[model samples]
Target: MSPATSRGPKTPVDPNAPGPMLRYQSNLPKLPVPRLELTLQRYLQSVRPLLSDEDYHRTEQAVREFEAPGGLGQQLQQRLVARAKDPKIVNWMEDWWLDQAYMGYRDPVVVYVSYFFAFKEDKFRTVPAKRAAAITTAALEFKRQVVENTLEPEYAKGEPLCMDSYKYMFNNCRIPKKPSDVAGMYDPFKNTHIVAIRKNKFYIVETVHNGQQLSTNELEQQFQQVIDNAGHIPALPIGALTAENRDKWTEDREILLAAHPENKAVLEKIETASFVVCLDDSSPVDRDQLSRACWHGDGRNRFFDKPVQFIVFENGKAGFMGEHSCMDGTATCRLNEFVCDGLNRNKINHGSEQVRSGLPAPQQLQFQVNDKVEKAVAEAEQHFDELIGKYDLTVLAYQAFGKNLIKKFKCSPDAFAQMVIQLGYYKMFGVSRPTYESGQTRKFQRGRTETSRTVSNESVAFVKAMENPRLPNEVKVAAFRAATKSQGAYMSAAVNAHGVDRHLFGLKNCLRPNEPKPALFTDPAFAYSQHWFLSTSQLTSEHFAGYGWGPVVSDGFGVAYMIKNEALQFNVACLKDLVVGGKTYKNAAYHLKQCLEDAANELRDMLIADMPAQAKL
Candidate 1:
C-alpha cells in the first residue's frame, strides 16, 4: 500500500465503534469563511503578476472601495459567515460550488468535464477476458469495502479527509435533467450486476449469482460470453446520446422513453448497475493512443454518465474514466490506487477456480428506437466526432529524476513540479499567464477543492532569472527556492480553507439578484486573473501509466503530471490549432511536451551546480 493509504499501527476496536471510513466525519470542521480583509489582500497579491501596471492600479482602486468600512464586501462577508454558522448547514459553499462548477454547466461531459487515468500494463494477464475479470474482481473487493464502510479513511499530515464522496463512487450515475443534472445512487446491496459494452452493445453481467459473488473464472466466462454475443456488428449506438450537449440529450432522452414502454426499464438497468466495464475492440499500442482511448473513446461504445467506468481494450490494456459531478479526483484516485495495488500484489481473493455449471448467459440490454430516436443518435455521433477531433493529447514520461531528487534539494516535490510547469509555459510564450493547481479541502466537512494560484510574483522572478543567460547558477537557485517556498505557503493556506477563490466565490454568490454589481467583480483584471491558461494538477501512483483531462479554456493547456520515485510524467492536452496573438500553433501539445522536458533539465542542472561538492554524491 502507498504511505498515504497505509495504517501504520493496529488498534483495538470496540464492536459499537463507527466504521473506519467515516469515523471522524461527524467531527470534521466546517469550511470557514475567510475574513474579508485577508481575502482581498491575498487576491491582490495573486493578480499582480498577471496584470499590467495600469490595470493593477485600477484593480487596486476597485478593491479599496469594495473593502472600505460599511462597504459591499463587508456586507457579503457577514452573510457568508451567518450561513457558515448555521447549524443546519454542513458546509457553506458546498451546494453553490456544485451547481456552478458542475451540475449547471451545459456542456458535454466527455471532453469538457470528465477525466481519465491510464493504468500500467498487467504482464501476467494479457488475454482481454482474463484482464477484465481480474480488474472486476479487484474492483468488487473495493466495492465491498466501500459499501460496508470498512475501508480506512485517507490522511494527509495525520488528519483524516472527508470520505463522504465515496458513497457516490459506486452504484451511482449522473442523470441528465433540464436545468441541471442530478446524481442517482442505487442501493449498493441490491445492485450487484455490472454493465459491459462491446461493439456498441450493452449487456448485463451479474457479479453475484445465486446469492454468492461470481469467482474470477466464472466472471471471465461471462465476459467471454458478452464478447461473443455482441458479435462483429455494431448496434445503433444509443449510448452516443450521452455525449451530446446537456439540453439536447435531455430532450432526446424523453423521446427515447416515449418511443417504447421498455426503454425506461432498460435505462434503469444501466444506471442502477454497480458500474461499467467497456470491452473495446481496438488495440492502442502507443502512449498517445492509449491515452486517447481512455480519455474519450469512439463515442459509440461508452455510457459516459456512469461515475466509474473501467475500460479494457483488445490488447488487454485498461484504464478508468470518471464523471466529475459528485466528487473530486482524490476520492477516485484512492480507489484506483487500491485496485492497482491489490492486483499487483496478488492479494485479491479470486474465490474458487471451478466454474459453475449451467450458468445463465449475460442479458443484452436492448433499446427500442423510432425514427426520431434514430436521427438523434446519428446526430450525436457526428457531433461527438467533430467535437473530439479538435483536441490533441501528448504524454512525456520523464525518467531523468523525480521526488527522490527533489527531496534532496530540500523542497516539496509538488511545489517543485509546479515550478517546472511555470518555467515551461514561460519558455514557450515568453511570459507567464494565470495558472491553477487544485488544492484538496477535504479536511473540512463536505469539502471539495480550492484554487492554489500558481503564477505568483516569486514564480515569475524565478522563471525570468532562468531565462537570462547572464544570471549565475546561485542566483537562479535562490529565486527557485523562494518560488517553491511561496508556492508551499499558499498551498498550505489553500488546503486550510483560507484561499482567495472559494471565499470570493461565496461572497459573490451572496449578492441578491436585485443588488448592484460590485466594482471589484466588474473589473476586467478580476476575470483575467481567474482565467487559467495552464490548468494543472497532480495525482501520482506507480501503477498509473498516464492521467489527464481536457483544458478548461479554449486556448489553454491541461497539464496533468505525476511525480514518481524515479521519474516524472506529464500529460498535455490542448486544441490542435491554438491561435495566440494572431499566430496559429499546430501540434501545440507536442511543443509543450518539449518545453516541459527542457525546463526540467534546466532546473535540475541549476540545482546540481549550486549543491555542495560533497553532497553531490
Candidate 2:
C-alpha cells in the first residue's frame, strides 16, 4: 500500500461533488467515550508489567474504590457522555485536548514540539535552486488541491478518516500568546506568495505572478535572486526569537511591534504566506546531519511557527519541518508524500520554461531593529544555541530485513517493529518501562491520536525470555507471538478511540474544581505508566531518509521509526546529558541504535530457527 493511502474498501462518491475532501465529515461518528468498566479493566492490564506485586495491590484497591457502584468514576463518565452528546460539540475531547496537549504548553516549538522529515536525495535536481523550485512547485500543487477542496479523503478499514486538519496545512501560522497560543489562518485566495529564508534574511517569493502561478523556471530564478541578494554575511537573525520560550517570545513580540509601526505589516506578510522555504547554506552529508538540520536548523533561519517549511540545503539536500500545534503528523505526512512522490514520478506540472517579463522582484522583509530588538535577537540566538546543543539525534537505517521478512513470520509489521523497540530498550536497561506508540484516531470527527502503550505483560515476558540464555527457541517464539498479539490488540483499541490514556484524560478533565480527587487519578502507578520512557511513533515512506521529534520527557528517548520493504529506519533522540536511575547515559542515541540492530537480528534468527519451513518465504 502507498504510505499516504490507508487501507479501506472503496466508497463511491459523485464525481461532481463540490467538497470531496469534506463530503463524509457530517456523517462521521463522534469520538466515543469508552465504558468506565472497560477502561478500568484495560488500565489495570496496561500497568501490570510496570508495577510490583505490592504496587499492583494498591492500584487494584484504587481502581476498586474509583469504580465502586455510584462512585466518582461513574460520575465522571456521566459528565463525559453528556458532553459527547452535545449538539454543538463535534468531538468532546477536541477543545480540551488541543488546549492541554498543544496550545497550552508553553515550550519553544523548535526542539520541543516540532518534528522533521529528511527526504531521500533527488538525483535529477542537484542544484539548491533547482531542488527548491521543484519542491515549491510540487507543494503548491498540493496546496491548490487542498484549497479547492478537491483532494480525496483518506480512508482506514473501509471508512473515511477526518479531513478537517488539512485546513491548517497552508497559509496558517501559530501565534504566541500569554496563556495559550492561537492558530492564525489567512484566506488561501489572498495568500499568493511564500516566505523564503536565506542567511538569516527573509524574502517574499511570489508563487503567483501575472495572474498565473509561477513556473518551475520562474521559481528557480526567484530563489536564485534571493540567494544572490542575501549576500555572504548573515543578518541580525530576528527569526531566532521564535525559538525562545513561549512567554519570552510573546513579550519580545510586543517589543518588536512597539519598536516600529511597519513591523506589524512585516509579521503579517510572513504569517499570511502560503508556506516557508528555507534555503540553508549548510551541506549535510549523512542521515544524522540531515535529520538534525531538518529537525532544528541553526534555529536562526527558521520561523518555527509556520505549519509547513521546506528546507533546502546548499548541497541540494531537502527536507521538511512541521509545526505540531494545529495538525498531527498524518496530515503533514500525506502532504510530504504527495510532494515527493509527485516529483519522483514526474507527475507535477513544471509549467513553461519561459520567465515572464516584468516579474516582480523578491521582496525582502526588513525588520526595524532598535537597541532593544537587537538585544532580544542576540539573547534568542544564544538561548537557541544552548537549547539545541543539549540534544543528540542518531538515525539507524538497518538493512538486514524489514516488513517483507516480518510478514513471513505471520506478524503485523507495526507490532513487530514495536517489539523491536521494546527488546532494544530491554537490552539497554534490563527492564521494560512505559512506552508510547501513537495510533491515529482520524476515523472519528476531528480526531487526532491516542496513546498505544507498548509495554505489556506479554511484551515483558518476551523480552525477559530473549534475555535468558536458558530459554528454548520454541518458548521464545511463543512469547514473541503473544507479545505481538497483545500489542496489536491495544493498538486496535487506541485507533478506535477506546484506549486507556485519553479516556482517563477525559474523566480527569470532567472533575470539578471543588470535587474530591479520586484515588485512581492520584495513584503512583498511574503517573509512572504514562511517563513514556520510550516515546515511539511510525510514519513510513520510501522517499524519507529520516524523521523524528524531541523526547516528551527529559529522561526519555523520542524514537521515530519507519518500516520500509527492505530496511528499518530508526531516529533516536534524547538529551546529550541523559541521566536515568542515577547513571548518566553518554551517547545514548548511539547505544540505542546498536541495541536495535542486535534485537532485529536476534528476532529474525529465532524465527528462522524455530518456525516451520512452510512459513518461511
Candidate 3:
C-alpha cells in the first residue's frame, strides 16, 4: 500500500471518545519531498509518449542538464524541501496551490470550477415539498454533527483521511475580489437559516427558532410558501451575476451593494447561511438530466458562493453543487452521502414540532437593480446559457460488471478502469497521449491532491495490443497486466507526494525573480504533456446517481466516473464536438461506454482462457 493508503493504527470505536476527529492529527507524517533525480527521470518518462522521438531526445537532454548538481533545479528543490521542513508551514504547497490553481483563477465558477453530484433516486418522498423538507432536515442533522465535531471521520481502506476540509463544508462562502478571491467561515450557531432560491428570488427560512430546529413539516410549509410566493413573475436575477468571472463579478458586486446598502446585509445573510436549498422548477429524470440540472441550472437558481447547495428539483429529484474553493469532491461527497443515506434510512431526527403560530414566515430577499445591474445580469445569463449549451453531457451506467468482477480477476479496480479509459481514448482518437488522474494527498495536514500521470509506454503498448486483431489472447493479457501495474505504481507515487507534477510545480514556484526560467519547463514537451487531453478523477459511491465537472481544457474531455458493486457510471463532458484532422470527439460518452464494455469482455475471455479448465469452470 502507498503511504497515502496505509491503514491507520486500529483503535476501539468509542462513542464517548474525546476529539476523535483530531486523534491522528498530531502524529500524521508531514508531506515528503522526493529526490530531484527521481522526479526528473519520471518527467522524461511521462513526456516521451506525447512527443516525437527527436523532441523527446531534446527534452530528455534538458532534464539531465536541469538535474545536474549545483543547477537551478537543484537549488529550487532544496528550497522546496526547506519550506516543507519549516516549523510554521503546516503544508508547504497548500497556500500557493489553493491561490494559484483555484482562488486566483478568475473564471466563471459554473462551467469552470464548481462540481456537481446527482443523488440516488428517493422512493419514499416523491412529493417535492416532502423531499425538500426531509433533505433540509437531514442536512441540518449533518450540520449539527459537523458543528459539534461528533461526526465520524471518513476512511479509505480503513485509513483516516484528513478531516480538516470538513470545517469549510458549512457556513462558508467564496467572496470575490479584484485580483484574487477569499473564503469566509462563520459560526455555525449564528447561521441558523437556510437560503432558498426560487424563480430567481431569494428566501430566508429560519431553521432554528426558540432554540429548536424547525420540524420537517414546518420546513415543507415554508418551502411551499416560497414556491407559491414566487409564482410566474420573474424577479431580477441578481444571483446570475455571481456566475461571471471573479474579477467581473467583483466589480458588479460593488455596483450592486452601492445601489442599496441593505443589499449588503442581504448578501451576507445568503453567504453566511448554514447552506442553500435551490428549489429548481425543472424536474429531471435519468443520470444525464439530473447531472445537467445540478451542474449548472439557469444560473439564476444558484448562489455559487456557498460551499454546499442542495438542489431539490420540481419532481423531488435532488443533487448537490459544490464550490471548489472551500473543499474538494471527496469532502462534500461524504456530506452528501450522510444526508441522503440518513434520509433514505429514516435515521435523521425529523423534529416533531408542528408549525407554531408565532414563527415568522419565510422572508424574500429583495435586490434593487438599475440599468447597469440589469445589463450585467443579462450578460451573465447569456454567458451561462451559451457556455453550458455548448458542452455535451452523457452518463454511461454500465451495469454488466464493476469492481467485484475486476477483483475477481485479481486486479486493482482503479487501475483496471484507467486502462479502460486509455483504450477508450485510443479507440476514439487513435492515440494514447498525456492523461491526468487525481490522487488524493489528504494523508498529510491541509493536503489536497497530486497529479498521477496515467499515460505511459506500458499503457500505450496495452492499447495497441488490444486494438491489434492479430495479437494472441495471452500476449494481450500480459500487456494488460503490465499496463495496470504501471498505473498502480504511478498512482502510489502520486498519493505519496512523489509524483513529478507537484514537485516540478514547486520547483517552478521557487524560482527567484532574477533567475532564468528553467530549460526543463521551457521545453515544448513540458507544455504539451501537461495540456491534459484526458482530465479524469473518480469518487465512487452507490448513493450518487452521477457526478462530474467541466473539462480542464477546451479540446479535452473531463471524465468523472463512479465505480459501484454492479455498475460503472461515467459523466463525460467536453466543449462542442470538433473534427480536427478527421478525428472527432463527439459523443465521447457513447464511445467510452462501448470501449469499456469491449475491454472488460476481452479481458474476461483472455483470463478465462489462461486459467485451467477446472478453475475456469
What are the per-model C-alpha RMSD values against the true structure? 2.0, 1.8, 2.7
- lDDT of candidates 1 onward, in order: 0.92, 0.93, 0.84
Q: Per-residue CA lDDT of candidate 1, range 327-383, in tens? A: 999888888898889899999999999999978889999999999999999999999
Which pairs in model 3 have colliding backbones? none
| Model 2 score (lDDT) | 0.93
> Candidate 1, 31: how far from true, in Å?
0.5
Candidate numbers sorted by lDDT from highest down: 2, 1, 3
lDDT of 3 by residue, 1-617 (tens): 22323444553344544576656655556778889989888888888777789999899889888988898888998999999999999888888888998899998988789999999878888777788899899888888887787776766556666778888988889999968899988888888988999989999999988988899989988899999999988788888988998998999899888888788899999989999999899989777889989999888989998889999998889999999986888888878888887887779888775677787889999987788888888988888887777888778887878887667778888988788889888887788877899998887777789999999889999999989999998899899999999999999989888899888888899998999998888998888889887889998878889999988877788889888898887788887674434576676656666776776666667766776666644
Q: How well does candidate 1 match the true structure in TM-score terms? A: 0.98
Estimated TM-score for each candidate: 0.98, 0.98, 0.95
| Candidate 3 accuracy as lDDT | 0.84
- Give residue 280's error in model 1 in angstroms: 0.3
Q: Best-fitting candidate, measured by lDDT?
A: 2
- The ten-residue window of minimal lDDT in model 2 covers 1-10
* Model 3: residue 221 alpha-carbon error in angstroms: 1.7
CA deviation > 4 Å runs, candidate 3: 1-18, 579-589, 608-617
Q: Give residue 216's lDDT in candidate 2 (0 to 100).
A: 98
